[model samples]
Target: MEFGVSTFITDEGIGAADLGRALEERDFDALFIAEHTHIPASRETPYPGGGELPRIYYRTLDPFVALTAVAAVTERLVVATGIALVIERDPITTAKEVASLDLISGGRMVFGVGAGWNREEMRNHGTDPATRGALMDERIRAMREIWTAETAEFHGEYVDFDPIYAWPKPVQQPHPPIYVGGESERAIARVAEYGGGWLPRGNVENLGDLVAKVRDRAGWRVPVTVYAARRDPAVIESYAAAGVDRTLFFLPTQPRDETLRTLDEFTELAKRHT
Candidate 1:
């Protein structure tokens, strides 16, 4: 039961370099940053949390650049995108970024990706909101091809490319773990089909039910990571009993002191469970 923390990497938050050092000092398992390439002005997609989006979404730093800064400062603290918006990014370039970050971090990169829920945001990237699931699927498949093949090619509805060589293959064999994020049935299937794990959003009821359904339906023992707003011990125990491999706590802000305290608390939680 490894513990991780996710926060917005904004201009005003703790710098990624400092955050990395802090996590390493506290011996936390990983540091994940959430992503939103560029939120559109149109308010077509309601906030998943049922409130106005945070200003941090617009002020956030690029995830790869921020994680790279983190890698430069830490030795063992894993870095990741809590939910990288692959729908808005190019899969080929994204694969190289993941590989480069993994190499720089000594293979401690977890790629958590999702087909985001913002309709206007996807439209801004020229992606159809209705078909994002299919698009994301092809992107994941294409990325795997790029990561594992000496000369790779993929032909799908959303992604099609001729043979091309990709350099600096990921240090981790067969590439770093791709954790599919979201709770829909299609999302679980996507994880089983291409990802190394499933990253279910927080606020899930019946953790055991969902974990069992995913395992029974997908026929994969992929890890299920819960991203939660609260880290109550009882809740953690319930999730652990349900076979969740890791539970990442969502931090409200990235202040160094507050984050340090949470890391210590969560580390204690991890010690008890793991």
Candidate 2:
């Protein structure tokens, strides 16, 4: 199985280019960055991890911009968005950014996306929290159209556009692989319907069963990538046995020395499994 690392790229963390080079040097498969345009100040939305929100959430660099810097420095490392908040983005512009990054990176972009969880955050983007799922679906479909077609157009309840030409088509044949993120049934269904793979959050109890469900729904082999997987050799082996295609461990956004040390530890874990 491929091994990767995901982290919240913040201003105080290791620089993107530096981190990318480091990961590649360590022989890691990918570097996935988390994205949040801006965090709402209100504390209405509880943190997913069930604690005070981490400081990195508010200080994250734009994933596309950060990943571009990563791609510039790395030759083989897959640069990805661990979970880009598509609900807050313009599909047309996001499509171009994905394509441009893919082209410039020699087709090494993985477009991992989600509907997002923060209600007030979605509101800031003029998106209704209740309908964000449907909106995300339409936006993804619309972006796929923009990526593949010479003259693309899409009309839906949430996304409507006329045929227009966008250049710098992705180097990957159709487009970069879209990995739908989340662990819910709806998220799995979305993966079956439109995504190239599934990006499930880590520490699932019955991961093999989940992988089977996704494959059954998709009627094909759907790649399953476990995000935030624990950096344990046995855990990695368990995931591999459960048919995981990749396992991305979480890297704390910290100082360069500390971050590299964590990577070194994870690299040792990877060696034991590989």
* Predicted structure with the largest lDDT when compared to the true one: 2
Name the weakest run of 10 consecutive residues (lDDT summed) in model 2.
229-238
Question: Which candidate has the highest TM-score of all?
Answer: 2
Q: Where is model 1 poorest over a 10-residue stretch in terms of lDDT?
A: 251-260
Model 1 gets an lDDT of 0.84
**Every candidate's CA RMSD:** 1.7, 0.8
Per-model CA lDDT versus the true structure: 0.84, 0.92
- Clash count in backbone of candidate 2: 0
Candidate 1 per-residue C-alpha lDDT over 83-152 given as tens digits, one digit per residue, 9 for 90 to 100:
8999998999999999999999999999999988889988989999898888888898899999999999
In candidate 2, residue 135 scores what lDDT? 94
